[model samples]
Target: MTTNTRAWRWGQLLALTLGALSSLHCVELPTKSYSCSSAEDCQGLSGPGGVSYVCGSGGWCEAPAGSACPQASTPPTCSTSNWCWDNPLSEGRNLITVRGRSATDIWAVGERGIALHWDGTCWARILPGNSQQLRAAWPAAGQTWWFAGAGGSLLTWDGANWTSQALAEQVTFHDIEGASGTSAIAVGQAGALYTFNGQQWRPQSWDAGTSPAPDLLAVWPVSNTEAWAVGRNGTVVRGVDGGWSRVSNPTSVDLVAIAPGADAGTAYAVGRGVLATYANSTWTASSFATSTTPLNGVWTSAGVTRIVGPASNIFVLGSATPEPSGTSQVLNSIWGNDTSLWAVGGSGSIVRRAGGQWSEFPGGVARTINAIWGTDDRNLWAVGDQDLIMRRVDERWSPAAPPEPGAFRALWGSGDTLLAAENNPTATGGSNGKIHLFQNGQWTPSASFPSNGVNAFWGTGLAPVWAVGTGGLIRRRDEAGTWLTEGNPNTASAQFNAVWGVPNAEVWAVGAGGAIFRRDVSGSWVSQRPSGATELFGVWGTGSRDVWAVGLNGSAWRYDGTTWTQVSTGVTQTLRAIAGRSTDSVWAVGDNGTITYWNGSTWMPQVSGVSENLRAVWVTQTSVWVAGANGTVLRLPL
Candidate 1:
């Protein structure tokens, strides 16, 4: 598609400096369990928020407590100051571009201003204090690396300190390349072209002769004096002798990426089914693919050409033998020399091409998490879309061993007994609602129940389990271990989202259209209405007397064993789930990364470093855990 600039960012440079490390108090970290004989084995080890680690006396890795880890220098505009993504080690965010000077020293940047680096050991994430989409990078051997992204972000990192320059324009820079540390060219939306010559940045004008100029997506610098940038609708421009101008038309398939060939004046540009090359001072375009398979990136080194795109498609120019990509994930960018190569793309996918084989490195799950529960930090479980179930054992997160796939929307467990509630909202007639029971090391579907979807679960310990679901379906398991249907409290057509209570004594389920149902002492389901609230999605409490329910439009309600009353939650974002460690340590999370804390009296907001809709929250005595869209899990110290 032809490009027109949409949402833009104009940012002021906010610089932060890192201090040298010194003797620090050690904090025993959870087990990554990489056995080390010396300190070097733990060098590249990092945890959430890039928490630094060191080789401990036990021949294991541990974190240096209170050490300075790079975080946002700006004070959180919300309630609390510390919130970090805790799931999918390495990095869970999608990687857009990859570049490096060597196999070990590599940089991959992607959505949400996330940068990952490989230091001859393991991948470590670096947060540059910005959350905008980053899609451009430039790497020069033995020199500082350059990264440009959305919000006019331009920054440089020297493996130690960071320096940033605030570009005045409100545009996203898609690609940046330079000949030396001093000279570089960047291009982005609306045909933006900027040149940096060591001292400062100066805008270079280029005309597309259209109302909205095409986006300049990729840039390749052959030398300090020559470069090329390509983008939508055959947008190709060249820089030579300190001037920039439009290039001759070739293909109009929206060239996304361009790469230099084996020699000067030789390059390749690729897009949907089209591959265009430049040589002998002329541009040639041809059908590179039999079908319209979009090629996202192209690279060439010492006569080897590799093109990559969606579904693990890797093609070499003039060769029919396809590269053996071990992963089926889309590849966004490729860079390397003759000896080694690397490609990164969607869903934190990174694959290495070395020893004539391609292998994907282990990364985190990228699905939307629906619920999070656990006994402590060392043992936690999270379930999300597509039957994704991840477990944290000894503080290290990994997918549970074939936990039998199921869409679990609510999870509750204690000690060895855990239950996962299936999120089925489309029950037609029979007892189609389902649940999963965990045993040995895997999860299996339970027998049967009413409704098609079970949205929530609650119980005393494990024996008497209570569940609620779509069509206001409710069920109970008695001492005889038999699951039986319960009354729907006159709201059988509305879907229930959450359930919590004492097994047989009391239970509460809340869901669609502000519907709230409670099972009283006499074991009869009754409406908790006059609820005066919006669609409620979650219900929780400290005990039988005090309870809380949260839902759409930031609605919050409290029950003191008698009636449910509404409370004002300053913000208006939809709240999906709520949890608390006690009366004063309650947290509710919802859409747009919303996090609010209830410190006994008033509810306040906290900043989560993500934009995916937050759906679940779990609070421990010392920390708060929240899970949501895109396998997002955030942790903040209490």
Candidate 2:
């Protein structure tokens, strides 16, 4: 036999004995040089399993069908940030229940009647019927689903259409389940229980005429003769051998939700961080140490427990398995001083950053604080719903007495004096537009606005504050207690929303439809024409020689004392507010969490990494602060 053939036979025998060897193993090899321009030209290089070699250009052996090989000297490549996945936006607060067949196929509903689906990778938000929270979901045959929630809300999804159904009683429907297409039960607040028999939903006959309101939270069905319902004040009702009986819970706190765990016969109920296991006709309570921080949701899947709270706090409980972690800043409102910083948002979230590290502050209020402002590092104020006004007196924040129950739109402060403009809730048959001033340790109501609603306000000091609102209302205070109307800016159909002032003489008012009015040294307002008709919302100036204005539809303009010139912002998002430490160092913020910088001649976009609507920007020599809806606040290094 030839030497090559003998070597091939021995190699084949070796490979056969080593069963671990894969089919790609070669039996024989002979070295020979071949020339080729393309893959098809390398004929003799084919191996037994279609493995072949090709030669091209510089004549190096390579895989028959592949791109050029990498250089041997090339180093490995990597990226800095993960840049792969980010936190999912919270569609609603107070998620009461979540259920899914798989990791990606899940549904969650909560306060504001919000419903969303998790399709394994990301969440796709769905519009549930009402703004009231949906508490439970029951999936039936043929893609039919039923949802129950606040105020007796019942909706059915038949794979295509979602229609609301009226219940017989006016109560909050909390839990629902079914054993078959014709047999279903629903229970809710006020000891309400309903039964459905294929054709219609009707009240279930019960003899507990003197039973207190149940406030039911969940329901489960084991079979035609066995079911359970759990609810408030630690109440549980069980169906035993075709009969119903009441049971007592160890804890008096409300049992918010319940579900069967790994063993279908075993069930669990969760309430106030306490979990109870029910199995084999007995119940045992266990304590789950959740954060002192207020929690909004608790969800379980595949033996894992996930909890979410304010400030983007998502925690996975259960012996530390691999899960998503970290606090993503869902900033709502932000304020900064020369030495300290603060921000607040959803779920009474409060964060403070000092010397470059952020920590959660425990003394935050419960409402969503919408506006934040301060005179200095020692004192600050945040305002929001439920008549909220929190004050930072020294290093800690305490809830202050809120002003009248109205939505606070704009806040401006100088020294210890402050002025807040509220959107008139009475105008459209709501509250009348009014201004509240904080001076001498008291919040006093001031002159009412001429227009129906206030939009924005800006000023240098306490007395000469300027506030603008709807219907082109301009209220000015010049060292006087009264707010008087200045000359109506002749922008025809535009409604002014913002006013910026270097002083009484050099004030600029901006609003919708690209209207900008400049007040010269005589307090006379003159309209500045822009190249395009886009609404302007914010204006800032380093001096009288240079000023910049930013607004909707990606509009930004600069005025150099003589003429106004359009500047390219490199973005189409609406710009809402502007602040600058110098003419060449200006920052503008707006809708979609946009931040644009002016570097002497060109405007460039910076990565703010947020999607909330930024309404205001404030800058100092060392830092910049941006504030927006959802209590979003972001600060970047100067």
Per TM-score, the best of the predicted structures is 1
Across residues 1-638, which tens digit of lDDT does each residue of candidate 2 receive? 00000001111112221221121121122233233456564656532223466653433333443322211111111112111101122321434555443343455555566565544322334665457767776666556678888877688767556789987687888777777755677888776777666767877544333466667776777676777777777677787555666776656666655655555577766666566678787877766655234333344445544444334444455555322121233333222333333443353344444443334332223343445564322234555544444443222233343345566777776643567776645535533567887664446787675445666777666567777766667777777768877755374345776777665358778887778888777767788867685888887786666878888877888888888888889989998888777767788888876878888889988777666677766654444655665444454545
Candidate 2 segments exceeding 4 Å error: 1-256, 259-372, 375-399, 426-431, 489-493
Number of backbone collisions per candidate, in order?
A: 3, 15
Assess every candidate by TM-score: 0.68, 0.48
Q: Which 10 consecutive residues of model 1 have the lowest summed lDDT?
A: 12-21
- Which residue pairs clash within candidate 1? 88-364, 367-631, 424-453
Residue 488 deviation, candidate 2, in Å? 3.3
Judge candidate 2 at residue 404 and give its lDDT.
56
What is the C-alpha lDDT profile of model 1 across 395-481, one tens digit per residue? 434444223435667776643445676654444453355677654333456645544577777776655778777766777766565
lDDT of each: 0.70, 0.57
